[model samples]
Target: MNRAERPPATLTELLSRHDCDQALLAALRERRLPELHFYQSGPSVRAWTELCSSSAYRGYARSFALVDAHAQTIASALPDRPIEVVSLGAGDGAKDLRLLRALASTGRRPRYTAIDASYPLLAGACAAAIESGYPARGIRADLLRDAHCREAGRMLDRQRARLCLLLGGNIGAWDPGDTLRLLRRLTEDQDYLLIDAHQFSERDTLPQYDNPTNRRFALAPLRALGLDDSAGDVHFRLGTSATVPGLALVEKCFEFVETSTVSVGGARFAFRRGDSIRMSSSGKFQGHAFALFLESAGFRIRHQFGGQAGGQVLLLAQRRGAGG
Candidate 1:
């Protein structure tokens, strides 16, 4: 309650649980192995850098605006109480910093906490927050686990009111139904959520991924693992399933065709043509279905906004009261 001095030490420490390390390790291994191999060769950093710096990467800005508006709403809802802002997947804290700066103009000093899985990004956020004169702290935790949610709940329990943000279409990047339930479990009473939802669209989604710029972004991390575009064939595809009405699911899968043998950590590894790696992140609900998902999440929508891409939705919702 007295302002955390630093972010949680490790994913396990933050969650306050220990059983899932093996499962988590496996997931991370699957996700990072290619990147790690590419990093060994030193060309992947460029892709990762470009991916984070491009205009498309700044999508969180829209969410930040919605959050600022939501903050104003919360200020009106709890006229005399202090508000605490917690951001899940708070990448680099740039967007949140904008809101904090605006809050400062209003003469309201809010306590801020940013939780992220990336240490480098968390460090950047910490530095930015400090420079901006915010009493901010960062927590490194994986939100997919229950223990982390419980810890987050404990942190929010102390605030008079809390605003939790899950930005960058992070919800769509995973299973929305389960993710929403996990989000609800982490939220304490009196907390609000400002989340970005992808509007479902029938247009060609592959071009976005296939774009040279976007492809560079995707492969940068892979290149870091010593895998080049020529090293493997990258494939993109969509998953058609009806989880909710009006929502279309498209999944981008990257298959790296290894052309030669590589070594990592003093060990040798080999790859063949048929061997493929899959990196599937979902893009969902580009339009109307976006609204329905929020309603199903037990949130009473207060307002919504249209994004520049025409397929993204930003929603400001309040947790439904008991019996609502």
Candidate 2:
């Protein structure tokens, strides 16, 4: 259709003409920010960085360093061939560097790819790999989208074996079923999947998300919706899945103190005084439960590593019957 003779189009269609973010718009319509969206902008990235540095949340990252202790074992488990590392949700590329260094020590140079939805985070991940003198590149991808996942798979060098890294106990950040489907998409018959999960113990995890820095990060979406601190209260509580028995998650949400409504793009969305909207949640698998979960989801667990009194775990997995 000719531009002058076209029918009326919605703002989204117009925005599309200028390349606006479809995912952000879709989430904004719900007045909530899912975990992936939390890192898309610089402000959110800085907020996450602040939370990660705080005493409350910083300790969890130390657990990921366990990969260093298990690197040689991980290398020995893999096939004796060139391996390219693909890091999903590769924020800052810190953890992948540990794995890459392990591969490098095997008398071979390793290639790395950091895929993320955030340009700022993607740039940092790519830069870290380049600075370490390893060949690397960043692919801008929304991990939640199947098309994006398939596109990323296409970019890999097909001849070499692939070791997919989904570290930082990230398995908790997504729904268990969703996570399983995602892993299947990211791996192939000969590929390796390195994933980790933090156990949701009331003692260690509860206080971490309830602290000041994390509170700020959780309230950001509500604040953007034009709600002030006085408009509601923030709470961190543990939730469980009805279907999956061992599954548990710590949820961060904002409860409205009074009835309120918001207007965006001429759409009025209502909120009750007691209603709440989630900011984020991480699925915490207890002990060998994570390993069992992977097997149930059709992934074959090859090697397992952990520390912090069994509160954390890293599993090297592959598709069922994928072993050479």
Candidate 3:
């Protein structure tokens, strides 16, 4: 079928799609802590919202400025046809709105689709997008799963060009191999991929996770599991690795100060005093390391944008070929 013959994609075809409830219940039944559920709880979501507002998170502003400065170029990269702005882990949809507005200013009004594992977050994002006059949809599916990605992609009008977003240093916390795998799953030939990273060097402030707000955000998951401040203390540590040289790692470890028992799935697990569990970690790449990493993952970096602080880097990449 020719592009002209295809029916126009309507907002109804892309409205709120979710499977988070079943995924969360299954994760809980397995006695495992899923990061996806971390934002599902009220406290975690609030803590994350607060964390985003903190002064240290200047990456958002810097990235937005970069996108705005090059809005025309970015928009020109898209096909002349209809475009779909698909943001993974969209959070409150604020950043996506910024990008969408930038694209609009360049005479492009694309459909916006926010994909997140948390239904509440996705719903809020979709609502905000709709209020802002963008055709919007929300998909509550784990982006890491193959089936979910396939289903999410299938929702797009076949002829529409896709711009997949993975922003806010989200990829920094993921394992390198898994990160590559996710990029591969999310992009197809000619599809655009916008990803951000938090750069780290010896000169940059290294102890960001030491802040109380940072601690609260990272430990929010533990709180959702019924553990409180008294149950443990969250600490930050810096480490280096031989495998990925020039990449600095900041890890958050929650150390139990006393004996604690948490109940899950009608069973209890014991945590001895002084036990330390690594909660989350972010890798800060230096110089051209991030570019090389992307190349290694089979992506060709089309453009690079740096934030004001010189720490937040955004890469506009394209899949190498159809298989990618």
Measured by lDDT, the strongest candidate is: 2
Cα lDDT of model 3 by residue, 124-173, tens digit: 88877777677787777776677777777677656777888887677766
lDDT of 2: 0.72
Against the reference, the lDDT scores of all candidates come to: 0.59, 0.72, 0.71
State the displacement of the C-alpha of residue 30, model 2, in Å, after optimal TM-score superposition: 3.7
Ranking by TM-score: 2, 3, 1
| Model 2: lDDT of residue 244 | 67
Backbone collision tally, model 2: 2
Worst 10 residues of 2 by lDDT: 9-18
- Candidate 2 lDDT at 238 equals 86
Arranged by lDDT with the best first, the candidates are: 2, 3, 1
Kindly list the per-residue Cα lDDT of model 1 for residues 35-145, writing each as its tens digit. 212211234434645655566544444455565555555444432456676888776677677666655556666667888655566666766776666777777666766
Poorly placed runs, candidate 1 (over 4 Å): 1-25, 28-49, 52-80, 259-271, 307-309
Best by TM-score: 2
lDDT of 2 by residue, 184-207 (tens): 777887578888778667678788
